[model samples]
Target: MNQDLIQTFIEETEENLQVVEESLLDLEQAPADQELIDLVFRAMHSIKGGAGLVGFEEIGELAHYLENILEEIRQAANPKLPDDIFNLLFAGIDLIRQMIEDNDLTAKSVGRELTELKKAIKHYQLVTQEGSSDEQTIQQQTGQKYYKINLKFRETIFETGTDPLMLVLELEEVGTILASYLNREQVDDLFHLNPHLLLMNWTIFLESEQSLDKIEDIFIFVKEDNQIVIEEISEELEQWFSGGEETEKLLRKEEFISNVDLDQVLAKQEQIGESLFLQSKTTKEETGQADKQVRNLHKQKRTETIRVATDKLEGILNDIAELLIAQSRVKELATGIVGLDRSLQSEIVNSFQEVDKLIRRVQEEVMSASMIPIGDTFTRLKRMVRDIAAEKEKDVKLVISGEDTELDRKIIEQLADPLKHLVRNAVDHGVERPEQREKLGKPPTGTIELDAYHQEGSIIIEIVDDGRGIDKEAVLAKAKEKGMIEQESQLDDSEIYNLLFKPGFSTAQEVTDISGRGVGLDVVMSNIKDIRGNVEVFSEKNQGTKIKIKLPLTLAIIDGMIVRVGGERVVIPLNSIVEFIDASKQQIKQVEGKGLIVSIREQYIPCMALNELLQLEGSFNNLKEEPTGVLIILKDDQKQIAVQIDEVIGQEQVVIKNVKENMGQAEGIAGATILGDGNVALILDVPTLFKLAKRLKVG
Candidate 1:
């Protein structure tokens, strides 16, 4: 196979398998839904075709077996898909996914899974037979019903190379045809007959337990070219001659019979659309619209899209970053020339401003190119939640919103592990068993909502679960026992919740496969922090726990307000700053152990001198002394605090350089950015700054 073709096959096959898995889950809820059954069948069919083209014989065979079961269901009048069948299907999907992941082609690698799936399929065949027998038994054990199938082939059917007799032979495979009438009223004499045209029509009385779908399949090849209809004439066949039965054609797109007057019969057979509407428990229009949407979605998927290697995107981003750095340098040089003509200086500033605007535009375009929807990751986590909840014997449902929210591909890749950990922990430890939840007046099915959105120039991912909320007392006790906190220290709710992120501080009584070793949450925190992000935990006992993670929009560049703490210059992301305030001693009042709270606009906001928070030498440090200069009001979402700074040194777009890559993560610092004057300024992480301020006041 061509390498590019093989790559496309693998990617497409993976996507089809995901659709199969998700559709299978949906099928478990509505086993009789024709659309859902068709969806699974089509997905498996697609995978089989793709795998066969790529020479993945084992994968193709496995997918074909699964597809066969779906085909049987689709053909049956009613399909009873027990939980075990769905389980088998899910197992098969997993096996296929593993094969694709490993790119396994050897027979030895796929033989075992293939055998197991074959056995499951064989068992499914037995189940389908039993289901059919049970249906017949419920119908009073009657031998069989008779269906009158009449097919009137158009005169051009022979031109279309259709053989009407072959369709009769195919119908015989489904049932016993007691009588077949060849309607040739419109046929001319042999001398004037067109040998290339079809003139005969068939009216057969078929008796069998087969479904309409099976009977229809026999004539599917010529359904559009012929007028065929089938009607249930089980007991009415004898009455049909007495005007008691409704006789219809096998296919009914147009009128075919003119001389044979059958006024008692209905005009046409029931359409697949009407049958699907009845089976789907939805309106016919809605079903049709849903199918249209699915087709449109597939059409969009088929629309040409090329996959670019991640390293190339990274290279482009790095170049953009360099361009930003050069742009900053030019701005510095534009203003540095002394005794220059005023017009020349203004023109230079204007030119650099335009360059800056263009550079920002390019930066945004590149970033957008690197962004991908988080829905795929969400789908994987949903599967994990389902499997883990099953293992733990807990009933759980994952509700996902904002799945189309896009984020940097690299950040999303790093986010996968942490997201998985959070979901697993929620399913395993947070949600209660069905009985426990019922006793607690909660629904037996626990709900876990995964939401993502943009806020304050960052991405906020929240995992909220209506389970047994975090036990703050238990967390506090765990921290004390682990020697992570002073036993006498009184911590607030937020402080207690934050202890869950401390290394090796778990509240679980014993370790399990899912969590409880205290490693997961800390890793989640570490991973988020690695990308200049923060995780906040909120919980109310017996209610639920909501974990909100805030991450930067992109790691490359940011609009920052440059300020000087003392001799040290720092950059604060412009999105986080609300305003600047000047305060005298009257506005700042010390509240004993809580330190100073500045009253601004009738709201009491915490105040921390920048020098004290960073532990640096500054002009202002002592709270007892009258505070002066500008107090920058910084708010990160709901948390707000006033930072006493020397002065605001204007704002500029800064290219972010990862400080941890060289200097390691520093407290209260997000990353470093180059200044117009060529000096390096540390970008302050607003969330971290709040924590530091709290600590400084507590001390």
Candidate 2:
């Protein structure tokens, strides 16, 4: 088999399995939903066929039995599968996923699990098929219809890695094969034939109680290029299965089977064999080269869509970022030509401007391409919540909204673990048990809501649970006992809640497998911050706890406001700045216990000198001494702050480069970007700066 075909099969199988898992979850909620049942059945059917075509016998066998169980549930008078059945189905999905990951199911433990699952499935089949008598009575009443299927596949069908015999075998699984014939008229002598070309056609008389739609779906992948005709035949033709001279005569008379000698054709096919002989005749390298050529040709024919690796897309984005920086440099150099003509300079400026616009458009499109809806990630969390709730013997329901909110694919990938941790924590630590909830005058079933929406050019995701909220005093006491904070430290509710993120910090009385090892939240905080996002917690004693995370739209580039603070040049994210204000010495005043405050429109917001926050030289020692400088008001959530800068150097889009790897983590800097003048400017992290300002007490 071709490597490309194997990879494509794996990718497609994984996607289909995800769909199956999601639909299975939905089916539990609406057990009698016909659409969901059929959705699952079809996905498993596709997986089974693909697995067989790829020669993954274990996957094919497992999917086949699972598909049989789904079919039983699908055809039942009441399509409500039992809880035990759903559990078995979910377990089967997990095994299939494991098989796909390992590419084989030969491991000792996996093989044992597979054997046990198959036995359980077989038991369910027998239990479900107790109604087969009624089904047979109904089929007798309606009379079975026979389908005459003629399959004339394209010569290049082999390149697609589809075995015509697999289609026949699948048909047999759905119903009884009354009669079958192979047409080998296109086959040449073994020495002269091309091994890659499919030359035979099949004529199958199938007696089935299935619909025409179901029969046609078997040929879905090949129907476009191949000649697949399915029509109901006379009931009398069913008698041709007796297999005698008269049966062959009848089949030939109907033009369903050619007059070729069956034995001779079988002998010729056996002589030519499958690709085994070809593989033995050619060197490994030659066969690989041929397979590559065939795969490339097949890829060219598939123009509707193609999957590109995510790393390749990332590489393209990075190259485009470099091009933008080069364009900026070119524009800067164009301004320095002392003896250039005015007309030439104007044309050069316009050309550069046009290129800049095109590059920006390309960047936007690439960024858009890299974004996917967060719904898939949200859907995956449903199983997590269900399993954990079941294990803890709690009744918890997860409500998800704003699933269509899109984020960068890279960010979404990195978000899965953190989101899983948070959701698990919500189920484990946040939500109270059913009895406890009822005693508190709350609903028996607790709810955890996962929401995402866009605000201020950023994505905000909230995991809110209406359960037992965080105990502020307990958290504070734990912090003091662990020496994470001073015993005399006076902290606000938010600060106390933030203590949960400290490493090895837990308020649980005992540890469990889910959480309570003091491991989850700190990892969540670290992962979120690695993507330059911020997480905050809000809780009320009996109300609930909400963990809100703010993330940038993309990690590659951002619109930044360039500012000069003393001798250092910095870029503040444009989305973080509220407005600019010019304040005099009197407008800036020192509060009793707070840092410097700037009065703007009757609102006194905490003010920090940019130079002091970043500890840059050549900056004013105090904002009161140089209150003449401009102040950029930055807002995060409900908190607002003012940072004093010497001057604003206008705004520009900059490509963010990670400086942490080279310089290690800095206090207030997110990353660094290269300016047009071949100089690097540090990108300011507004949220971190806010935290730093709160700790700085200036008089």
Candidate 3:
């Protein structure tokens, strides 16, 4: 019921789902690989840890069972993992995601699904462990712990502003702690970091002849509010006691310490310190600086890594921008001075430029720091490709390249689902089954190349499959049957191929349980377009199919041209502004009964009034005033419509702010930004406006 823990549960569940996705993908490809077994185990291990945090006992128990199966498989090197297990894991992951997102993945659904999976995994583990010695050894080693003293710090222990590190260090003095691991998995990259959360849970086998209350007495100062959990794992305690029997015999009832000659020991210590210091000084003086760092791993307290959030960075950049503006104003006034010296003015100019360059670099780096490599995502997909390929009876291998390519973290999150859809489509539809491909004289296994690289200030991800290429003829027939294409359509092969993206378009001869209803491709196209990306398909008769998706590097800020039409200003994305020209009276011609069109280099540029789109009033009665009016041309292949505006105010970097979700209408506007004068400018939605212009002209 605690909101903080609830939020943590959601975040942790998301990470678990990611693990499930990756693990399943791996299990599909290398079902018997020990590394994959470990991957799956780690996923379950983290899930169990998270479930314990929120007091979700059922979820925690289920995760423990999953972890057991994974660890068993890893130790035994089990080669034949069942399909049912992977399916159940996927289902669990989906259920968890739903539960977190909507709070609708009910406990009943979770318990039922988990119960089913637990039963299956237990049976499988029993079978696998019965014949495997390695599995038995692992089980015995893990089972040796009899007492599990789980000392969880109170939830308010953090928010009450108690120093968690002090508490952990304090616990160390209570007994001889055997082992400790910090649960740092929940720490994400966020700005304005306040380390007020207790994320560490201790599991220690203390050497003591004391009761649970005696142990709990150590936390007496804050015990009223803090958590002190003590569970006696008898079997584990027996193993620990048995292991230390020899040490007990060595123990003596004497206050005796290992006495040493202090003078001799001090001399040796001095000698060692002098040698190290001399080595450092000599190296630094002779070469460059000392080629070493002071590394003290013992005192290096394990703490979660913290990163600044994007909003904090944005605020910092904004301050820097204001500083730059002040600098610009100073430069402007200094130039306008009546008696300013030439040399002084030049010095100030150079200094201003230097400041400008440094500030810009810092801003860019602050932005770049938020970029996480795409490889992290691709690595997860390795498992997905594995399982899907198996289910389809296809021998498919996913070879990824340019994984180190980094994108904004926001971009990465949005990129995941679309990339998944593309890859799955490739596996389920494009990759031919092993037997079918061998019969065609092709290699038994198909290669699905997942490649990403930077080009034209954007990143391109491609899903290329070496199997039967898409049948253009079949696609055209399906389109005709679906009435998606007019009977008299003059569409080419590429155009026909694009018809696959039309909603509810499917040409599958037989429907499968997975994806034959053709819901995926349309979604892929829509998602790509949502991020202002484009997806193109290329297919040969018998070679293969390649679906390439190109996305902009970042969506936070954009260079846009502000233009006025009907006496109101609208901002156009600079990237989409292909060309701008002064509309000449002679060059302009009316398109029959349609709207105005201008001939520019043998291309007809359709024109729309900016004010009319947003319903703002303006006049263009005089052709002489309109002669100098700018025609801002935009093109997306789907349309080449130009908005006629009074004047182009040039380009400036504009930070995009979404009209807050589920709030007000942002119908004609993409987003809004503040101008240099602090005036709010609406970013025009080009695609929406383009569609609107066509509709109005036809009317």
Candidate 4:
């Protein structure tokens, strides 16, 4: 199998598995929800499709069998679904995943079990077809290949002046219309309904002399922007499609008692001749009314969501990073050579410029591939809260909105565990019990809401719970007991609340498996900070608690203020620099033997000189008469820090590369990136370094 195709299959399968997990959770609530069933079914469908494409036949066959059972349930009304069915289904999903993973089939083979599963589902369906049946066993062979396409696009696709309808209609011109089903269900009451969004699927049984290339060309323009799948189903699709005919025919007469094909099902529903009890208003008007009623039945058809794998995209990003590095190397080599080749340098520079533009374009697309809706993390919390609320015997409703808001995939993944722990804590520690809430004149049911929205180049995720708010006095007492605070420490409300994230500190009177470990918030804070994010807590005496986390949209390229320390170039994140100043030695004043504060332009600003803290070799800090190095004033809420440097090297948008693990976290270096001269500039971890310096001076 081709590596690229296999990689794509892996990426898509993982996404499908994520959706399957989510749908499985939902299935516990509404097993008959066709959309949920379809979601699980299509996940298998995709696994089967992709596996076959990548020559993983045994895995494809397993997934195909699993999909058959779900398809049976999905197509039925009030499906006789048991949890055992999905248990088996989940097992099937797991097995197929295992098979794909074990591509080499090193251990025990699942080929025999897969064969047994297919026969079992068929035999059961055949055995149970007498009274009630979900499907007639879709006889899809794993060997066949066919394209199954779905296209329900965002409105922007139409603004491109492309008619998706016309495109589909043109597709009809190229192939035999096979399994065409129009979801005209959404066409509703004309007076108040929307007609612009076309809802239909016309599966063409394409048998063209022209190659699949021609069939694919019809969709080339909008394919990338729309939900379009060009794939190969099975070789024996006719057999598969017709396998349900026996089931369909059986249901046509005998099994028509309670479903879509019931005898006089329309007559039983239709009221004729003035209802024979109301009035004689049954006429063309009645026919129109019946049509109107059926129109709005068009439910939203879902497409299998996909994303390129992060490691795959990361591979590409690494390549681009390498490309930029190589480009820098090229420019480095072209610099003023002894051969005196001005024309050659000029051409090389031009080539480097062109390559840079192409590299940036590819890098941007790869970054976009890494973006995902923040809602995925938000959805997982609903179940957690529900279960927690139930355990405590309290009513807590989780209201999640803004789920469609997107964030960098890395941030979203990193956020899940933290958010889960937070929500769990909110319910366990924050929400009041039912009796306590009733006494306080509060509603018995507390509401925990997870909201996300994009603002000004960052994604803001907020977890707000309406519960008995954090008591500042209580927190302060706890802080005092732990010796985390002074006897007369005067702190503002924000500072008091921020103390909850202190290591090994919690207000919970008793420890449970949930919130009492005291490691949750500290971990959350550290993780968020690591991603260049800020986390803040908000609470009142009785209203609620809300934790807001703001994270930047991307981690690739960032603007950094450059400075030279130890004659070695270092870059500081531009966001952290409060101000810069040139000061005299008499202007610098030491405080508590910790950091020096200088009154520049009236107010005293504390500073930690980089040379002193970094202890870089060379002597720039021992200034006797005047301030020798430049002061780049860095400040956070904790204290102010000025990294005195050899020179102010200005700023640039530097692409960051992570510090190697073996060398450990660099003392001041956040990451390393290539400068225009091809030299690697270390980016300073100003926040951590500043805090570390504060602790050192205090110690």
Tell me, by TM-score, which candidate is best.
2
Candidate 3 residue-wise lDDT, 1-699, digit = tens: 677666666665777667668656757667755445545665676666567655677666766666655544543423455565576566656656655676753466566666666677677667655764552324232111122355667655765424555545544544545444333334455684446665545544453333333344344335445555555434333322332433223211111111232233234334432432221111111221121111111123546655355688767756755664455456557666624566677677677678767866876786687678899788777877876776777788888898899887777888889888878877887878888888888999999898889864668888888988898888887788778878777666657777888888887767886678778778777666656567778998668999877776765666678786765667787766787777654266666767776777887777665666567777753332345577777865446876667788766556666664632544556677666555567887665566567657711
TM-score of each: 0.76, 0.85, 0.59, 0.57
lDDT of 1 by residue, 594-672 (tens): 8777888898888878877888776766554777767888997887888888878888888888888787768788889
Q: Which pairs clash in model 1?
A: 228-249, 228-250, 228-251, 229-249, 229-250, 229-251
Which candidate, 1 or 4, has the higher lDDT? Answer: 1
Estimate the overall C-alpha local distance difference test score of candidate 1.
0.75
- Which lDDT tens digits does candidate 2 get at residues 1-699? 878888888998999999999999999999866667767877898898988877788888889888877866654545556677788989998998887797763334599899999999888667655754443211111345567798888889876667888888889866887557777777899899999998887887676766554577677667768989987654444234434454545555644356656544334323322312222111112211222222123322555666788888899999988987887787678877724656578788688778878888999998888899999999999999999999998999899999999999989998999999999999998999999999999998999999999998999999999989999999999899999998899998878988988888899898999988877788888888888888888998888999999999999999999999888889999989999887554477878787688777788888878888788887474676657678888988778988888899988889999887897767778899998899999999888777777767532
lDDT of 3: 0.62
Per-candidate RMSD, Å: 10.6, 9.4, 13.6, 14.5
